[model samples]
Target: MKRFFQSIISSNSVALRTRGLLLLSLLLITTTFNASATCVRKDFSDSGGDLYGTSLRLGNINLTSDDLQPVGTVLATSVVNLFPSVGLTNPDTVMFECDLADANNIYQAFATNGDSNVGGFTNFGDNYFQTFFRYTALKLTNVESGVEFTRIWQKVPITHYATVGNKIQIRGRDFSPIRAELIKTDKYDPTPATNSFGCPGPSAIGYTGNYTCPQPNGYVAFSGPGVELEELGHDANLDWTSWGLVRYYALGMNLGPVSTLTNNNTCGVVSTTPLVTFAKISPAELTAGGNRTGSFNVQIKCQDGVESGVQHGQTSIAIQTSMPAYVAAQKINLVNGSGGVSYLLSDGYGTDSSVATGVGIRLEDSKGVTRYFTGWAPCDSTCASSDNSGWYPVLSNADSVGESGGYTTYESTYTAILEAIPGQTPKAGKVDATAYVLVKVQ
Candidate 1:
């Protein structure tokens, strides 16, 4: 009985050990399977015919929550150099194949250097191997929620590659996020006046537009307050350019809708239209033998579409002339005496003798000079009839004589004289002379 019990115990112990060993093996197998399931594969090839069947393998990598994390290792035993033959063209399309069955949740893929000393996370040093392209997370099978595999092909022109020995690496990631791929194509066009907006108008024929101004010296100007209009021309980019030619004065627009209002005011406010007229010249001054000329500019602001007919308005210029002189000549008669001497002059004509009395005189020195003098009458109290007291000098050198008591009724006669200034001359026919005096009896 003791022998039989020992046999049973040993067998049971062996059975337990065997079971333990089997379970350990099962655990190991499961770990390896899981690791292999999450790993990614990468490959490269030239889409163009220059290079053929070039292949490289990137080894197993761990899977992150939503992305596959590269193991930071390059599995390919041989390093290929492709820089000499073909250069990278569509770098973003390099293919990356993942082994995982559930391929949907991949979000991003990144390239990193492979040199161990270069480290993994942040040691993106030059010594490390780098991937040529990466892909965004894309939906694969409905049953899976991560990336299954991605195919990227790059095609380059023959001239682009110098030789066939170029090689590039690629790595991928898997995540539960959506990924987007971007493609770009570019083209350039260089034809002006191709579109309506780009078509510079007739004024731009000779490169004239808002952007071009005529030489200031070539044109006359009369711009209004806000009525300046710009010249038209082409810009640096061959685009049309123009500007406003404004006027300094206020312009009336009473002929348009803008000028009509309930208010009694006549001032007009309207859009500005520019019109230029050739300059006009006028005779400003004219003399007997000389002439003067003047010039001015004219500009108009009218409604567009208005007829280009005649416009009427009035403006004034000053007119002036120099003053003229007049002269006359006459004969004088004098009575000398006991009674004061009396004198008289004919009023140029003996007709109505009236004794050219109280003559007034005016003298103009030269062509441009003018002067005047007044005459005085004799006083009654001082020069009574028989007393030779009231006589006064008539000309600059003449003496005063009076009534009855001065001489014994003598009839002495005096002559009258008229003189002219040294250098003063009169206008053609404007000189005159005459005289008058008082007489008394004893």
Candidate 2:
């Protein structure tokens, strides 16, 4: 007997698709997929079957910017609301979706390089990669099929992100009614966008638009007909007379191996790295004060703890365009960068110094401000802690590094300048300067 649709077949393949032999009974879809799963998922036609297990993450994800917001702001949801696990035998299967397995760097931050599981996704604010980066993933809405899933407030070192969805299946094979399993709860269990798929912030305050946000990491809302995770499988064809509640992002996952950057060439080591010396000048005191000033004090101390899924407190001190072209032709950026006001300096530091003409050593930060030799100064959260647009921030409580393990320190006081290099004249012999600081961490 074992009758569950008893057995079946039918197809035409490709129009968008309508191929037959839908599922259930590969020994009950390999005991509902759990073969060492940690998100990613497989087993539609069985890439070797069984492998489905997710973890929404209850710890670790304190990257901070006050959890930045305002895009659609509902950053981290999914503590529960998984459906489809009833007296199974193929109940039209549904639930479980994830996205951004790596997305590939643009400057990719949060948990270093990103996504060992749920730590990424971003075209970021907009050069129009399409502006993604919302709740790192998990956007479903299947309370009997109203279909929804969205994101908000949670820019982190996160983990777990579903969209195409699965994990509570009833799969293929059907003959309709033979059902009767009431009281899945005592009563009034509305399923939330009223229960089964809710992330409507203010802790789901009674369906629809209920707003209020300042973001300490709290916000969520989802309307309807949504589905834009692009790739990462789970609409395993049930067609139940008209594609059950409809599904399409093209079908079953693709675009894997986004990148973690491998192959023995390695990098990342800080037990101690210091070098900030500048206090001596002449050549008529640099064009007789056309601009001559010097200041130095950059000391960083870390005794332990800061590697393992990376993302310790904070660290973002940009500007290091692989210098050495005689300190990259006297690096300068229109007035402290893109906001321009005219700025340039730092030209001499190993690789055999030779270009120290017309004076250049303009690096500032000690309230002297001025810094930005490259990109990043608009991700949001009010530019985080601005040094000068492009970024020169060092933060992580207990004074820097926060919690990875043991002691931490961040001291920086560097200023050397006089601004104004239109026609040139601070020339001399040896006023050595070499500035390079990229350092990014979550």
What local distance difference test score does each model get? 0.19, 0.27
Q: Give residue 39's error in model 2 in angstroms.
A: 49
1-442: candidate 2 lDDT, tens digit per residue: 0002433345335522432222335545556544423233122321110111111211111111221212332222112111111122232442222233332110101010011111111112211111011222223222222222212211111122223333222222211111100000111211212111112222221222211111111111111112222221221111111112122111000111010111111112132224445455665665555455666554444334433111223444444322232223434333343321224444442233554555554556677666554321112212133444444444311134343434455555656574335556545455444444433332
In candidate 2, stretches whose alpha carbon ends up further than 4 angstroms from where it belongs are 1-289, 296-303, 307-316, 319-361, 364-405, 410-413, 422-442
In angstroms, the error of model 1 at 344 is 99
Candidate 1 stretches with Cα past 4 Å from truth are 1-103, 107-115, 118-442
Steric clashes per prediction:
71, 34
Model 1 lowest lDDT segment of ten:
315-324
Query: How well is each residue in 1-442 modelled by candidate 1, as lDDT tens digits?
Result: 0001124334587898987898999999778766554322233333212122111111111111111112332211111112111222333433333323322322222111111111111112221211211111111110112221111111111111111123211221111111111111111112222221211221211221121111010011111112111211111112111111111001011001111101010111111112212222111211122211122111112222222211111111100000011111112212123222222122332333332222212222213222121112111212122222222111111122322322111111222212222222212221133322211110
* lDDT for predicted candidate 2 compared with the true structure: 0.27
